[model samples]
Target: MFNKILVGIDRSLISKKVFEVALSFATATGANLMLVQVLSDREEDYPQLPAYSYYPMWDDQTVRIYQQQWEEYKKQGIEILNNLAQQATEAGIATEFTQMSGSPERSICQIAYTWNADLIIVGNRGLTGIKEMVLGSVSNYVTHHAPCSVLIVRDTELLPPQSTSE
Candidate 1:
């Protein structure tokens, strides 16, 4: 039985499924749950704000606007984690949540190791081919590099079509 379970969550819809599975497992096994949310400045992630560039070519107003939006994104991320943590805590489970900024793939594994987790749970984005290569799969990376056992949860809607043989 796992004593410490670390769950990697994001703002994506599939994260709900991941957290649900993790919470169920933790409750069943009486394991403490740690929720980790990694935020990235990837343009696609914060499409509401103008993309920040490596080189500076923005007016003061644009920079200020981008900074404000970035702060709001971080606040939202923490709020999500807080609410999820409260849910598990209310269920009488020892739960802790964290918010970090960096590469999701690396951050997830790092937290798993630092927390000495017995199992790491994460969601699969179902990315494939060019999309996977370009975006890089966080679940794939965690599956390979996690310090402990890794559980990858895939959303039902993203499952591959099944073939039937008569």
Candidate 2:
């Protein structure tokens, strides 16, 4: 029943499974697929600051360097999205893509709303407890906030072991 499907993608292990599921849906239903990748700048990705009490502002040169780095990061994200788009296209599915810079959860939900997507497909990292609290779960946020229906693909290997009756 889905006409427009938006898939949130990234360069993560779980993304492979997400793509497979989304692609299957798109191929089966002949739905238009839109793949989106958000280029986030997590604090852990940057270098740590020194032990100085007062933090100095970035100099003009430093600003330029950071800008250049962000540009490269965006380019890399575009490349990844393009590759995914190609795969979808090869499967005879109509596909488009976008690369955004922001929080993954917000970006994915915003795009799904703006694009009028009928469904959003995202991968859940299966983080729980303290880890989920600290890192925040993008799929969880999208499930709660997305305007349209959301499908969270969880990696089977990450799922907890099931109990078998004797």
Candidate 3:
């Protein structure tokens, strides 16, 4: 039985499935569900290039752009988390949401360790070959390295909800 359940959610359509699975498990066990969103700092991604730029006489344009983009990303992430939390709450489950900037896998594992989560729920885009090798799958990483158990919900095609015919 899980006492603490941590679910990784992005703003992608796949996250909705992850949320459903997490909510069902949380409801069944009455566990505290923690929703996490990870955002990477753009500056970290583009390191080799000059950290700043400017027009003719200015030299802070690039830094300013990076900061603006980072803030916008965080704002978008927060909105996604809020929407997920709202949905989970409406389903009669208690949920907490948090965001951090870094490697998604690292942040997720650390939070799982910190929360001592009994289980971790994640979504799989089914990335393989080159894509999987270059951009490691978070679910795969967690499954291999998490301190606790992990549940990976594969992205599957779902049938449309049955319409009640009058």
Return the top candidate by lDDT.
Answer: 1
Model with the higher lDDT, candidate 1 or 2: 1
What lDDT is reached at residue 12 by model 3?
61
Note the residue pairs that clash in candidate 3: none
lDDT of 2: 0.86
* Per-residue lDDT of candidate 3, residues 27-142 (tens digit): 89989889998875322332232433434544476667667766777887899899889988888788899998789888999999998999999988777789779778788889
TM-scores of the models, in the given order? 0.93, 0.86, 0.81
Model 2: residue 137 alpha-carbon error in angstroms: 1.1
TM-score of 2: 0.86
Q: Give the C-alpha lDDT of model 1.
A: 0.87
Q: Kindly give the number of clashing pairs for every candidate.
A: 0, 0, 0
How would you encode candidate 1's per-residue C-alpha lDDT over 1-166 as one tens digit per residue?
7999999888888999999999999899999999998887542566354556434667788778778888888898889999999999998899998988889989989988999999999998788899899889998989999999999998878889999999
In terms of lDDT, which candidate is stronger, 2 or 3?
2
Distance (Å) between predicted and true CA of 96, model 3? 0.8
Model 2 lDDT, residue 99, Cα: 79
List candidate 2 segments past 4 Å from native.
42-57
Collision pairs in model 1: none
The parts of candidate 3 lying over 4 Å away from their true place are: 41-58, 157-166
Error of 2 at 58 (Å): 2.8
